[model samples]
Target chain A: MAAIKGFGAYLPEQVLDNAALAAEFGVEPAWILQACGIETRRVAAPEETVVDMAEKAARACLERIGMEAGALGGIIVGTGTPHRQFPGVSASLQQRLGVVGIPAFDIHLASVGGFFALATAVELCERYGPILVVGAERMSQVMAREPRVKESAILFGDGAGACVVAPGEGPVTVLDIKMQSDGTFVDDLSMEFGSTLNMNGRTVILQANRKLRQSLTELLERNKLAATDVNLWLFHQANVNLLKQVGQALGIPEDRVFLNLPRYGNTSAASLFIAATEAQAEGRMNPGHAVMAAFGAGMGWGSALLRVQ
Target chain B: MDIRAAVRKAIQDMAQAPLPADDSASLFTGGVIDSFGLMDLMTNLEEILGVKVPDSELMPSRFETVDKIVAYFQARK
Candidate 1:
């Protein structure tokens, strides 16, 4: 079975503290903290592209595994905020990593894109040997000052996380990955091409809670495991309260959940892997079963189960 | 607990702040509750009132205030 041999993440050095946002929006800093549990988030510099973050994260992952870029058989980048419209971020990442001519592509599933890309990598590993999967986003670039869009602007950050999926035994063996989407709620949260993001915050909250719970349940059932079996629960860092509610609904203990939203806000596609990598760094992830779940625009949601090796 | 009291309690517990004594105070427009707080209120209401709010009826207006939430659920019963 394909396993996550190594994992890495990168957050921009610049931090956008909630106090600054509160002052800019004329709201209480406590309100922003209470509403989403985000105290600060990373902001990308003007010159930092999605590929830049992806390359750093990918390099970290490769370094942890002590592997060279030339050893990669394929590359998959999951992102909704690509630097260019035509050539996916993976293309540039391939060139930067000196792994050009390898199969490279991007998945645009927004927040849940990381899980989808990892699932694809698991399958591609059979044909390609070892695959580099990166979930990166420069969400700050899309932030707009429009009144209606301000809330979303506060909710997103720029970051990237990557994992090296290869044919080997490691700390985590991917058991299964399941994904689903409903187009009806596509309008609930979206950014049309060339435009800024717009969202029905209330609707998206309700839909995200429902979809994440449903997907996580299905994944657990298929794996013949119960929620309690998951030792480490890495959910997309969307909102702290939403994650708490979903964990409560699933009967998962609060301590089992790993959250970094307070520091990173919502990094969209990069959220899950970033949390995973952080959990590992914190020594929270042990040799046991773990689950990762995410929900995003396209009303897409997915969950992946892993057995810690 | 009475429906109004239960609703108020839920809001207070979830928001960690007491609602205005006046029942007519706006919950949504006044920023008394955000979307996340609304979800918590729903879960608490379901448990306290012993009723499931159908997804179809989960709208902002129906629970815009403490009185409105109490009245809506009472009417449903």
Candidate 2:
């Protein structure tokens, strides 16, 4: 069984409210918020880099476990915002965590990077021992300096999150995972210039809804878990519309879907971990229930079913 | 202040600190400026140099180097 031993996250200090962004773009905040499930997004400080945020999250997770970073068998970072294209953010994190001799790597699946990264950590735990997975991004770095992509400018924020996963027998375990992708949908959500971020709203929404609903159904059926078994449905916090559509499609009930998109916009890869952290802190993931979900870019998506305890 | 010099000074102030001794070097390629750092450059041009830089001018190619940024501002003037 795979158990989440600890978790932590860092949200940027400034909040770009939906109303403020709406006024800036001459759009209606109510419509935008209702459609996107996003109200405010965090912007990173000039001094902060992708590596810096990831390091802070890694520190937080390690501190939570009452263990040192050196205790981990490996480190994995999920990000599309590496400070440099060549050096994997995970390698940088391992250096910062002082885990010099472990296998560390980075994966860039846009929003779904976190899920893919976590799945890799789960695989490592199956092969070796416990592992630390960190999903971090400094996306404000990719925002156009002149507010060119006003919709995107107002949509993205920067942050990081970390979780410690260990191989153990527990009531709470990662039951199953399902990931799928179609490169044809790649253009649906992407950044055009500088290999950064450029999203086509209509297409991204349509494809995400299709994939999310399909994946959620398959995951539930394969695990033999009913919708009623899921205590918390943590989908990627893309926008309000996608959340509503997915919830309605799956019959998971709106109350079961954990949403903070209105508060944080889309932190890309960091969304799920942050949601998990908040849900746990809020006592939403009590024992004797289950949690299920999917998310992110490359138009990539994955869903994980977990037993709650 | 002359328009060209104002543009030049704006470029200098926003260029990576300890401005490259030679202005021909590409700011981004030289590791002196990044996409976020370009924000300070854009803001300096807008607020200090009294230029309204529209969103379109934020492209990577246009603002790759100090010379290019100055050229962009001068052309707008």
Candidate 3:
């Protein structure tokens, strides 16, 4: 078993409202909000990159864990967007931290990246030591700067979130994770370019909804757990409506769903970690309580039953 | 093998399968090549062709299908 040593999140200072996007794209705000469930989203400034946001989040986590950079066994940054084509974001972060010897790498799980990255970190920590896992994405860079009314553009934000995990026999332990993939329907929800997000609303909903329900149920049953056992449900903040629909189908109460979409659209890989941080800060989780969930891009989906520390 | 077939084989291996049924449509637009799948494809292209596909060239239009991928390499050659 391993414990989450610390957690941190960073939301850029900028906020853009649906009305602003609607006016820019010649679409009604109500339509966008009703269809996407996004009222506002965060945007990174020109000076901020995915790596920059990740650093801030990782620093906060390191500070909370009371560990120096040199103590880390590994650093895994989960993101699809990188500052460049080579020398992954994780390597740059390792260099910036001046932790020269530790192993570092970047993963491209897209939205479900946070969980996937965390899962990988747990494995690395078991084999090595404490790991710093960061999910940072600058989705704003992919937004269409000129076309004000693009549907997919209105549904994402830029930010980063991180957590430090160490081996411990704590009450909070990662129990089980159910990951499912159906590559046959890959074209439904995706980015059209390195700089642009392209999503087919109908297809993404169908795929996400079906898989999310099935996986969550199987994970809970396999672990011999019930939905009532969970204190929080930190879902991937991809689509506001999608989250709502998935929640409704799962019979999860609205309060259990930690939402930052109004403030940070879809942060992609950063969404879940940020939600968990907020939950902890609000004192919503305690030992013995379970945190159950799902997230990422394959539109990959994973559900983990975690015991609170 | 010709460039087109070679590119197709490269993508097939990257996806861990034979060529997808429709090899002409855009992979991104068609949703067949996802971010992870695309990364896998890029790694194959770099290793197989011995040419680095720049980050800027990782768009849907460029690697939509086996034909387009081969064309990209052909032009580069």
Candidate 4:
């Protein structure tokens, strides 16, 4: 079995609030707020590459555990917003972290990318040592080019979150994880390489609610656990209202849900880990079961259960 | 509770604001409910009205105003 040994995140210094976006888009500030439930989002500096953010987050995670880069058995990055099409962030991250001769790779699962990486790390941890998983995204670049998609541009931000997974007993234990995708809804949300992001917001919202509910329900049932047994519900920070709807449908109370989208907007793959770290830091995550659910582009969605010691 | 009152309460609860005095006021165009808010309003309606709005019926024209929402449910009854 594998457990989360350390967690950390990197959010850019720049902040883009709703008022600035509303002024740029020629809409009322309240419109942005009510539409996506986002007050502000972080924008990466021009100099901050995806690898830079991932490196920092990885260092922070390693620092938390007082471990060095050489201690990592492998590195896995989950992201859709890569700096370039070739040479994924993992190779550069490994070099920058000074941990050579270790296997490293990237998983492109859109917003649910982080959980995909975590699940991969858990499996690797069985035969390896500590594995570093980072979910980093530079989404603001896409938004900057396509300012016309006001709703999507305003909802995406740049950030990265990282965690060190090791095989041992710890506070956070990975019990089970499941992921599924339906290509039929591929056009619901998508962004081709070097192209602007496209989304059918209403249809995506409807599909996400249905898919996330099904995934979470099946996860709990397979584990023989009830929704109430979960003390914390962490889902992708796509939209606050979407999360609320899914939680309501599952009969999970609002108090049990953990959210940080208002501050960071939708950081795609990084959202889940970002919220998980912040929730644990704030003492909201007690030593019990926590359910994490995420859905995004590719019409993909995933859910995982963890027992927090 | 009455159907109209239930619809008003759902809107109020989702928007976290007082309902408009005029029932004909547009909930969508008037900015009383947004896309996300609209989704919440639909879920709340299903709970309060004891009816499931099929995906085929989830159209903007049908949910334009409080009056239309009430009318739609009334016709179903």
Chain A TM-scores of each predicted structure, in the order given, are 0.96, 0.93, 0.93, 0.97
Calculate the i-RMS of every candidate, to one decimal place.
2.3, 12.9, 11.4, 3.3
Of all native A–B interface contacts, model 4 reproduces a fraction of: 0.12
Tens digits of per-residue lDDT, candidate 2, A1-309, equal 687787788887877787877787788888667545676788888888888888888788788778787788888888877788777898877877777777888987678888888888877787767788888878888874554566677677788888887787453577776677667656557765465456755456555666677788888888787777788887767676667766775787788889877788788888788887777778787775555455666767888888775
All candidates in order of lDDT, best leading: 1, 4, 3, 2
Q: TM-score for all predictions? A: 0.84, 0.76, 0.76, 0.83
Clashes of 4: 1
TM-score of predicted chain B versus true chain B for each candidate: 0.87, 0.72, 0.72, 0.88
Kept native contacts, as fractions per model, are 0.23, 0.00, 0.00, 0.12
* lDDT by residue for model 1 (B1-77), tens: 57877788788876635577788888866777877678778877888888888655666667778889999878866
Better of 2 and 4 by DockQ: 4
What is the DockQ ranking, best to worst?
A: 1, 4, 3, 2
Angstrom error at residue B75, model 2: 55
**Model 4 chain A weakest 10-residue run by lDDT:** A142-151
Best first by TM-score, ranked: 1, 4, 3, 2
The docking category that best describes candidate 2 is: incorrect
lDDT of 4 by residue, A20-49 (tens): 999998999999998888999999999999
Candidate DockQ scores, in order: 0.28, 0.01, 0.02, 0.17
Alpha-carbon RMSD of each model: 3.8, 17.1, 12.4, 4.7
RMSD of 4: 4.7
> What fraction of the native alpha-carbon contacts across the interface, defined at 8 angstroms, is recovered by model 1?
0.23
